[model samples]
Target chain A: MNRMILYKEWLKTRWFLLAAFLVLAAGTFYMGLSLSKTVQFNGADKLWEVLVSKETVLLETLKYLPLAVGGLLAVVQFFPETARKRLKLTLHLPYPQGRMMAMMYGYGLAALTILFLLQATVLTVSLRHYFVTELVVRIMVTAAVWYLAGYAAYIWVAAVCLEPTWRMRVVVIVLLAALVRLLFLSGVPESYNGILPWLVLYVLCGQVLIFHSVARFKEGLQD
Target chain B: MKKIGKIFIGLSLALLVLWLVPWVYRIVTLESYSTPFTLYSCVVHDFTSLDRSDARNFRFIDRKGNVYGDEVQPLFYHSILASKGAFPDSLEGIPVTEEMVEHNSVILSAEPKEFNVKKAPVYLLMESVPVRLELHDPEDAFVVRKNGLAVYRMADNTLLEEKTGRFNAALSAEGFRFPANLVAGKPSHHKEYDEGYLLTDAEGKLFHLKQVDGEPVVRHFPAADSLDLRQILITEFTNRATLGYLVDRDNRLHMLRPDGTVIPTEVRYDPAREDLLVVGDLFYYTVKTSDADGEHFFALRSDDFSLVDRMDRPYDFEEEVNLCKYVFPCRLSFTSSDDGWVKPRFSDFSWIGLVVDLLVAVFIIAWRWRRKNTNN
Candidate 1:
């Protein structure tokens, strides 16, 4: 209900903001260097061509970093500190558990958005040298799917860590990996090259699973 | 009390089955079974042992004999040889070009938004196995089994060795049995570069066939060193059998083995003799040539590192050419030569049909689930 509270807290988390910025910076540098080289060699001067080319190079490098770091950070980012503090703070928060959970997810998603936008900007810059077309549209679709998947991963880790038992977390992660492999194996024969669909399906399923955390949240620093 | 419980249970079960349709449909109607024809492919190598990757393609034939088509994927060598990701298209983007559509002589009328025609078509069924190249001829393309021996049609409808074994055993193991109505023909009119053979049934169902030279006793080998036995060769090797070879565009050699192992060799090929020679790039094979007075040894360069010469005969051995060229390579080079045959192992599209069946089951289940939900 109070979305602004979540957004404000996300802005207040200095470490999280810094991490997001670093990811964007690294992504931009990688794209800039790659684009310069591509222009020198291929002469891809159209805005669309440059955008697709540079953005692809940039986002590909930045894609996995967010998922991995975001997942780990979810455990600590806004997690209540002590058992007493959790009751006094998270439990006594000014919103229903659903809205609070939504805020956490919102923050994670915001971080991912920033990273993708930076990567997309670099891609657009590269495309400007090439041509003006719907290259940005293609890049947006690809980057959005990737960032959403990463955000889901972050939320999943944060919620799992809130629950007690590291062993259970490990078990859940392994199970999730196995399910993804099954989906891939099932989809492959139908697809000519099955990997893309597998990737897309994993992100979709991950996002779905992340929503479950929101549906079943408890205000506790420890189980 | 018992009567009421039974009535409630029966109604719930009926409703539960109705809610499962869409999921069933999604699985059942996958791309594999969307088309009517079974696709068969092989790679055609150039004079050099390296395959012309772009030259990779497939052979398709319908069960009714009404349709046949050839789909050519892009060149294989460009990506590997260039060591650049700048390959024309990703394996998914490999297209059914005008050339491919024209090659099979199948009419092209429909264009859809789903597929990327310029790029992004499925090339190899498995990336490791190069997409099968349709040998040059359309109608002359044939794959058949005779007296338990696998046979393929060469240029001009000439029967050539393809594979051998108890056909029933291999087909059943591969989850494919011979089709009921068998038809036979070359894939296309051009046989100039195509040294392999093909076989089809009356219903247009197809299989790879070839004959081995030695004894009536059948021999079996693994199809590839990497994959499990189920995927190697289709079935157990039985007596009265022959061996089969597929020269892929990447110069990767696929040989069907007994006990169902598909052995992929890094050998070179001589298409004229339909033999696989293990000669490397720096090495050469010596074939004997006959002059008017005497026979002289001729040296043929083996630059591409192929397992077999693309022909049945050695390139320099035969004088008159044509069929003799088919025999020369078989006699010379590499290990003691077995009478080698080549056939296109048609993709087991039966999986797609299974998917469709599963979709129907899901649809029924979904409908029943929704009905129960509504009742509750």
Candidate 2:
């Protein structure tokens, strides 16, 4: 039954996952090309000096890409189910409803994790070619928060889609906007070093909100 | 499951309310005010400041509330006063010249955000004894590791094994340990000269490292070993009176001389939490340090570092009472004026605001009850 649920989620989001991967690959490729050009025009010494002295990681393009992919993937996977009222039938399947929902969310989470890891690996490989290990690690630590923001975006969008009432959906959206703002308050590299663990906890606890929306749907509640 | 979800949602909403309500209140009641720029005047033998409260015309006032027009300009604005041919021929029986004022005057500022940042552990060691008497950036950079220093040629990112071995041997001979605790230097060719880097080893022993004539010049200063050093700042002031400033664990400021002597100054400065400004002339050094509470001014004689005068200006509290404490139980901020790191900080909790919070809750409940009755 879990395989069937996972397969259904894959069938719904296969194209989107492919597009996200391609978009991420193109971004990484562009970053690599730009870095190579900089090293070619001005010697590697100047490039290293800029990286050490400046507050930039040269990965600003990837900042919002993960967030966009996560939000869009949630919409692609769940919007049709809610819009066509097919979620009610899915809830009535032979499997336990809680397990069913968990499997669906787990599949999405797994796919996103795999995609984000690939992106991180590409960044590490490319950055290491021109920078030392310490500098490369600094960039990775700075980019960690953006990837976490992606997961939070996915979960919040899922919660909004599953909500039965329009008023509550709007409320969830406002709260999600505020919450996402917290993840991007500072542009200084590694500024989130201290609060990253608590932010991860917040994202994990937020998974329960989707269950609340589904529970409302089960109660035959609608606006 | 529904109950748990509702509780989480309530908690998230409460966090937002606590963080954002006070933020909005402060923004709405924001006022524009700046601290006056105060400097000690040798002529008046007291502190003088420009009163800018009246934007149309600024008045120069002494500490004793005596206002002066334009005649006192030569005391502070020596260059401009000299250009106007109103320069003093002699003051306090010492002859004054524009060249002397230009050379002796120095301004040093230190802010918390500048020091409270994480930086990459790579340093550019400029050549101190350049071929043409002008400092030039070196082709190699060094990183201190647990074993020793490793020099990498920035052009190809390859190790300079011979140079690294030479410097490592010199450091070992001087009893320097690996894994430095703090490395401070002015790493720019724009400076008058290069002083290389001042480093504290793993055991907090201070060592001065510089490159002269393409070789290493390492000096160990054992006088600082007894002091628990927290930070060191290298200065290349035009006067060349001192090498740098050393901050000890007790928040005391010390002047480091090129001859390996450290003299304690009479200024109270905490580099981690305060902003420091030092304005020096030929005779006296006026140091200003500001923190959350207020600003402190210290005047020290330039020759012996003795305290001449001191003053304090506390921040105004009446400006903070404009509905902030009454509306916000606590303020939440991610960025701070004291540091550059972005982390959550909840401060200034007001028990009075809890009464307002309760009233808001009662109002919300009453409105909800009325709405339910109307629907019925």
Candidate 3:
């Protein structure tokens, strides 16, 4: 039954997952290629020096790609389902509603994780070919918060979708926006370095927000 | 379980409101007042302020009612001239000249380095091009790791095995241990010559580090046993003034000379909050430090670190907010001007918010109890 639910969720998200992957891949490649052209013009040594002294993270263009992809993925997968009350039909299945909801969200999350890892791996490999391990890690660590913001977006957008009224959704969205802003508070590279593990925990705990929305939805608190 | 989740969300929303409302109100209504740009003068035996609090208006005056450059250029130019010995008869009748001020002037600043938010300690060592103070294209950059255990070049991201080995060996030869405490340097092309970095070893000993001809040059400086050194700043001044100032564990400032010696200055350091500016002329080294308590100006002679004159002014600037603070006596701010961190830090505390919270709580409980009694 969970497998069937997972299949249903995949049916909704598979195309978005592909598009998100390609967009991120293209962005990563463009940045790496730009760095290559720069190095060709002014040797790798100068580039490394600027990164060290100025804390310049060369992959700034790619910073918002994951965030945009995550939020869009959530909207694509859940909005239509909740729009026509399709979730009501799914709830009537013999499978427990909680398990069914978990299966659906879990599948979407797993797919996003795979996409982000793909993006991370491709960028890290390309960066390593030119720069050293320390710079490579610094770039990756700086991207950690933006990537986690993807999961937060997914979970929060799911809550907004589960909400049964426009008034509640507006308030919830404002709160979600404030929450998202927290993830991007500092553009200083690696400002999020030591705080990442706890941030991950905070994002994971945010999963409960959607469960609360689901409970409220089942209570039929409609506008 | 569902009820608990709902309550958790409610509490979080409340906390967010608690943090936001007061901060927003204060931001919208608060008026700002700051003291003038002040510097100490040994010649005048008081603080000299360039007061420009009013827009498009400025006055240069001593605390003793002496004024300078009333109609044209400010008296600051005259002070600068005196400090540099250009003005034979200074406004305050001090004996100074250009040559004496050029060689003797030094700046000792002690603004604590805030590492609350970590940045990659990556530095670009610009090539020493022909012109001094001219920024050069970087040939390489470097980061010291694990207490100077290794120095890796950033270009190809490889260890400059020979340079690293030389530095490590030199420090070991100097009887210093691994994992240095503090490493300070200014690696830009904007200086006369690079002093490289000042490293304090694991056991709190001082050493100088510089790169010459792509080689590591290390010099060990015998330090005072009570040094408890915390931070260092390296200035590549034209006069090759003292290497830089160091802040010790006891919140005291010291100067490190070029020949690897230390002089404990009379300046007090407030690690919590310290803003210091040191100006040097041929005759006196004027140091100004400002903090919550007030502004302190001290002038010490260039030859010996003896207090020539001192000024202590009490700045109770917070009293300006006493009337309007009833609206917000305290605010929970995640980030502070002092450091770069987004953690819950309560600031601007007063008795106002406490009384308000207690009163609000009492009213709520009383209303709930009254409702229960009416139902019974």
Candidate 4:
């Protein structure tokens, strides 16, 4: 049953996920190419100066792409089921409905995690070829927040989509926007180091709000 | 289980309200505010002001609204009193020489933006004894391990064991402990000359360490005890008359003279919270520490480092519009100035906001309950 559910989740999100992967890979490659060109034009020593002494992480293009991908993932996965009332039938299936719902989320999250990790690894490995350890660490730390922004957007979008009623959805949208805004407030390298733990907790806890959506859909509460 | 989900939704809404209420109130109440560019004039022993918007148009006005500058500009330079006057022949009662202005005028600034930014904990210990101060590029950076035990050169990512031993031995012989707490220096090549890093070891003892000709030159400043030192500022003054400012735990400012003597001065600064800017001229060193409240200006004698005058002003924003006091008595904020991280900060709270939130929650629940019964 879990296999079937996972397959259904993949079947629903494969096209969108492929496009997301391509967009992310292209963005990462552009960041690498741009950085290599800078080193080529300015020399490796000057590139070291800007990275170590100054605050240009050279990866600003990757900032909001992950966010859009996350949002679109949630909408694509669940909106069809909700519109066709297929989700209602799934809820009535002969299984613990919670497990079935979680299986669907689990598959989507696994795909996203792999996509984001690959994006990070490619950028970091390429950065290390020219930059030394200290410079590479700073660049990766600065870029980490944007990747986390993707995760936060993904869960928040799920919370919005799962919600059954218009009144609650409106409130969820406002809250999600504010919550995501926190991820991009500061661009200073390593600035996110301390709050990152709490941010992870917030994102995880925010994901729990989707359970509220599931409960509402089961209760058939609509405005 | 379903009730837990409902509670979570309520909690999320409450958190959003906590952040948004104060921000919205601030947006509605925020005003455009400007304060005069204030400087402490040594002649009058009070704060002198120039309109921040119009530097040329503003007269040197005293706290008493007594306007003076036409005569003073000439004294500093016959040209400013003339038009192109650079340095005056004399000040109120003392002779003003071109040499004094050249040596005395220096500026230093400290803000959260500077210290709050994450440091790599790597420094280039340039050869301080060299006649020419050639700065090091980022490629030559090195990390000084706990108590100078090891110095790892970042260029080749190699440890210089023998050199590190000799440097650490010199420091260890001079009552230094292992693992330095604060190592302060300006390693950028853009400076006129490099001043060696000032480090306080684990025991809080101060030592001066710099790399010279591939050898570590360790000098100890016998002036300060380590336990009380809060932060170090290396001014690298051109005249080399003063080393920099040392902030004590009490936030009292002290002038570090070249002879390794710490001269306690009345530059009241909150080393942790406030941003400080020290501007030195021939006559006085104006130390300004600005914060959310406003700005505090302190003028010290350029030669003697005495408190000549002081002035304090509160920004009109806090004074003019304060609806948070009435509406959001207690608020939740996720950002802070004291540190670089953004986390949950609950501050300036009044119970009124909490009570209102409770009312909203009740209304939400009651409204939903009524709708369910009507549908049934």
Candidate 5:
């Protein structure tokens, strides 16, 4: 039954996932090309000097890509189910309702983790050619927060869509906005290093919020 | 499940209200003010200020509230005064020239944020005695690792084994340990000269490393081994009387001299919290340290680090009534004025505001109850 639910989620999101992967690949390719062009023009020493002295990550253009993909993935996966009231039918199945909801959320989260890993792998492989291990790690560590923000966005958006009433959805959104703002508070590379563990815990705690909205929907709290 | 959801949502709402409301209040009540530029004048023998507090009228005033109109220009702006043929012959009974003032003048500023931020371990070691008499960026950079120092050729990102071996041997001969705690240097070629880097080894021993020509000049200070050194800044001022400044674990400031002598200064400075600015001339060094409360000024004799004078100026806020204390239970901020790192910081809890918060809760419940009764 869990396998069937996971398959259903995959079927719903396969095309959107493909598009997101392609878009992310294109962005990574563009960044690589731009970095190569700079190295060719000014030599790699100048690039290294700038990276050492300046507060730039060089992967800034791709910062918001993960966020957009995460938010949109949530919309693609959940909006139709809620809009057509198909979730009510799904919840009425013989399977335990709590396990069913967990399976659905777990599917979405697992898919996002795999997708984000691929993006990070591509970045790591390309960055290694031009930068030292320390420099490469600095860029990756800085980009880690954005990827976490993506996960947080996906979870929060799912909760918002699953919410039963309009007033409560607005409240969830305001809270989510403030929470998201916390993830992007600093542009200084690796400035999030000290607080990253707590932020990860915060994102993990947010997973329960989706269950909150589902519980509301089960209570028939409609607007 | 329903009860947990309600509790979670309630807690989130409370956290948001506590964080955002005070933030919004601060933003809405923001005001603009500038600290007057203060400098101690050797000729006037008092602190002078350029007060542009009023946007329209600018005043140059001495500590005694005496305005000198434009006559004070020569005291601070010696170059401009010399260009206009108004430069004084002597200051404080000592004959002065434009070259003397220009060479002797040094402004050293150290902010807490600069020390707080993360820095790459790589360092550029410029040749102290360049062939063309002007400094140029070195072809390689070095990193201090647990094993020893590793030098990398910057052009192709390759290791320079020969140079690295030479430096490692030089440092080892001086009894320097592997893995430096702090490395400070003025790396830019725009400076008058390069002082290489001031490093504290793993055991808190001070070692000065510089490249004269193509070899390493390593000097280890055994005297610094007893002190718990926190930070060292290499200053390459044209005067060359002092090598750099050092901050010990107790937050006391010391001046590093050319003869390898560390002299404690009378200036009280906290390098991790306050901003320290030192404006030095031929006669005196005016050190200013500023924090949230106010700015503290110390004038020290140039020869001996004796305190010549001291003054304090408290900051004034435009808002007469601070609503933050009465309206906000606590405040949340991600960034701080003291450091460049972005991390969550919750501060300034007002126990007085809890009463207000309780009253607000009662009022909200009463209003909701009254509305429900009317509807029924």
Candidate 6:
């Protein structure tokens, strides 16, 4: 459960991390180099020109690197081998199985946090050469917000994938994501007055699902 | 299995219908381009040669091709015609003078004199009829071009020339009658007329042609609307090999070609080598010049007149040109160099940039996956 042990384990996989960072860095660098000559870099402060200008929003969307990385992290967390290891460890561990799983989820969150910090440091250092004063804060804030979104995804993945019923958890996770997005767009805003209670009901169901997964994990260890 | 699957299928169908319904309704109810406009008069400036750097020193050419440097006022007097075919009876009086105390609205009555002084009082008739024109009161002057071709109302109700020996005086339109009360006059010299008469097409193509055979003829392409350009100065017209020339109104010079093309003097002078620039909804392209030693210039689209990129500039243009917003009174042109071409440089990142992204993506995935596996 030690945070230090989790950090050391993540550090051991530095080679793989280096490769992923290279892919993102190359793409971002290409963008910066291409944009340096255009109005996007030079005319960022011109309100009308920037707002109506082409490629302005496209360049802004590139800053959502963290969210992409987080989705991939979710897939990796759900790998079958990891599920087997968790089940085996719970049987022998003296601590309660649910507590152990919670600790693992915390460990996954810490890894994502470190990845975000690394990305922030790299982006800041690279932007220094451009010397564009107006866009520095916007770019930094964009990176931070997207990284936070990635962390939220990590939390959802950790809670779902540790359950004994892996296939069921996957189906539920996808359906829930889809439903929330739909309800947020249609049910809530279409003057559907009954949507609030339904939303609360959905949240309650989510809580019960997590409680059921924890109970199943403890029972699986006992069996 | 049967009931749950059927429910899922129904839900999917409902969602698809919900999404497509709005789009279908939008297509059915959408109206095509329809913008309404009321007829009004605005005194536009007549420019001969604009230096962009100086407004006061702009050399204004007259209809007779003589250039003069002086300050001319723009007076806009415009109102909706009360009746379409009826001659305007409002302008059926002698122009206000010092002796006419009743006619003088605010200023005291002065001596009735010919328009011979340095700054002459001039007026513009927006929509002209044979008898009456939408005349602006004498007090409301100088929003339109003051030192150019002007039509004012005379006491006799017949349109007369305020200046002697200019050009065709007997020219008339068959369907449209000359408003009787309107009188045509010039400010001081023929060069002042060159500063006023200008033509802008539906595609934002601006042309200021010199009045040859009395008035500059405006022939709109495809369905050409032949409007006699009241005041304009044609500086250069090369029809042989290159069908392009620069025309001036007061001081503003616009570069135009025969094939429905207009490149504003401002865009030809932009510092950045952008592929395109937008003015209102219309787009103007930035491109290199055709001649061996020409610089980067702009060319508008022939059909619908969107921007089309030409080439880059050979020389490094000044940065001050970027501040122009059509509000500033300056001589502007988007010029390009045909001699040399420079490719856009992209050197913001090295090998490190690639390494960073890959590392970051891999690290997050590997770390999270490992944690998930070990915990389970």
TM-score (C-alpha) between model 2 and the true structure = 0.94
The lDDT of each candidate is: 0.36, 0.85, 0.71, 0.74, 0.84, 0.35
Q: Candidate 4 lDDT, tens digit per residue, A1-223? A: 8788888988999999989999998888888888778767766656655555565676777888878877888888888878788888988889898788788777777888899889888987897786556667877887777777777777777877878899888887887788777788776678788888878787777767677788888888877
Each model's backbone clash number? 140, 0, 8, 16, 0, 93
Q: What TM-score, computed on C-alpha atoms, does each candidate reach?
A: 0.34, 0.94, 0.88, 0.87, 0.94, 0.32
Question: CA shift at B2, candidate 1, in angstroms?
Answer: 34
Candidate 6, A213: how far from true, in Å?
3.8
Q: What digit string (tens of lDDT, one per residue) describes model 2 on residues B91-198?
A: 767998878877878788989987888777888767888999987766778887788898888877788899999988888888899988899987788878888999
Model 4 misplaced stretches (Cα beyond 4 Å): A43-48, A51-56, A129-138, B51-56, B73-87, B92-95, B124-138, B144-176, B313-318, B336-339, B354-376
Per-residue C-alpha lDDT of model 4 across residues B286-361, encoded as one tens digit per residue: 7899888889888888778888777787776545655665555477876666666666788887677567657776
Q: What's the true lDDT of residue B276 in model 3?
A: 74
Ranking by TM-score: 5, 2, 3, 4, 1, 6
Residues A92-203, candidate 3: write the lDDT tens digits: 8898888877887887788889999988998889888877677789888888888998988888888788778787677668767876777877667676665678778877
Worst 10 residues of 3 chain B by lDDT: B68-77
Tens-digit lDDT string for candidate 3 (B1-376):
3575566566566656667877777678687767766665544556677757543455667876776432222132456545555554443455545555555556556553343346565555544433455555555555656656556555566777786677678778877777777777777665556677787878888887666656656788876446888767776666765777787878787877787778888877665476777777555677888876777877776666667777887785555444324644466656555555555666677688668767887999899999999999
Q: After superposition, how far is residue B5 of candidate 4 from its true place, in Å?
A: 2.7
Candidate 6 chain B lowest-lDDT run of ten = B107-116
TM-score winner between 2 and 3, please give it: 2
Q: What is the TM-score of chain B alone in each candidate?
A: 0.19, 0.90, 0.82, 0.86, 0.90, 0.20
Once all C-alphas are superposed, what RMSD does model 5 give against the true structure? 2.5
Task: Kindly list the per-residue Cα lDDT of model 5 for residues B1-376, writing each as its tens digit.
Answer: 7677677778878877777887888788778766888877776777878877643555677889887543464545786677778898987788888888888888899899888888878787678999999988776788777878888877777888999999999999999988888999877888888889999888899999999888899999866777788888888899997888888988788888878888888777888899999988888888999998899999888887778888898898654565877976777788887886877677888887878888888999999999999999
Ranking by lDDT: 2, 5, 4, 3, 1, 6
Candidate 6: tens digits of C-alpha lDDT, residues A146-213: 45546544544544664566664665466446443433232101122223344334333343343455
Encode model 1's per-residue lDDT on A83-168: one tens digit a residue: 23452355366677556655666676676666656666766765444332233344444444445445556655654544344554
